[model samples]
Target: MSNKCKTAISVIGIVLSIALLAISAVLAEEAIIRPALAVTFTVISAILVFVAIFYAAKIDYETGVYECRKCGHTFKPTFKAYTLGAHTLSTRHLKCSGCGEKSWCKRKNRRV
Candidate 1:
C-alpha cells in the first residue's frame, strides 16, 4: 500500500479508538451497565490500532533489497537503515558498503 493509504488508516484507527472511549464515557455517565458492548468496542479499537502499526512499519525482511547508486551494488538493508537513515523509505544518507561513500539508494519490491 501507498504511504497515503497507511496514513489514512492510522488516522482512522486513532479516531475510532477515541470515539469508542468517548461513547464508553457517555454510557458510564448515564449509569448504563452494558459492560460487554464497551469491552467489545475497546477490543476492536485495539485491533485497529495494531493494524495501523503494522502498516506504518512496512519493512519486508524476506526479499527486500536496496541498491546503491554509486557502486551499483545490491544488498539487504539493516533495520537501522530504515530506523536511523534520513527516513524510513529514503536511504540517501546511508553509506554504501562497497563504495565507502554516502549515496542515494532505491528500494526494490520484495521478491516473492
Candidate 2:
C-alpha cells in the first residue's frame, strides 16, 4: 500500500473513533443494553484508531523522500545521510543527487 492511502485510512480511523466515542458517551447516559454495546464498539474503534496511527507513522519513517531546492532532484537519503549534516521539518542539509552539492533541501510530501 502507498503512503497516501495509509494516511487517508489513518485519518478516517481517527475521525470514526472520535464520532463513536461521542455516541458512546450519549448512550452511557441512558439505562439499557445499548449502553453495554456502545462501550464494546467504542473500545474496538479506539483500538483500530491506534493501529492506524502506528501503521501510518511506520510508513512515513520508512519512505520519507526529499527534494533539493537548488536542484530539482528528488531522492531518499538514509538516516545517516540526514545526520551527516543538519535537518529540519521545512529544510534539510543533504547532498543533492543531481547537483552533488551539500546544501539545504526542502522536504517533499510523500503522499500524493
Query: Best candidate, TM-score-wise?
Result: 2
Which residue runs does candidate 1 get wrong by more than 4 Å?
Answer: 1-51, 54-58, 61-63, 88-92
Across 52-78, the per-residue lDDT of candidate 2 in tens digits comes to 666665565565777887877888777
What TM-score, over all chains together, does every model reach?
Answer: 0.48, 0.48
Per-residue alpha-carbon lDDT of model 1 for 1-112, expressed as tens digits? 5545545666676677667667776775676857787677667767766665554454343335677888888776666665467745545456777777776777675554
Q: List the residue pairs that clash in candidate 1.
A: none
Q: Give candidate 1's TM-score.
A: 0.48
Shift in Å, residue 100, candidate 2: 20
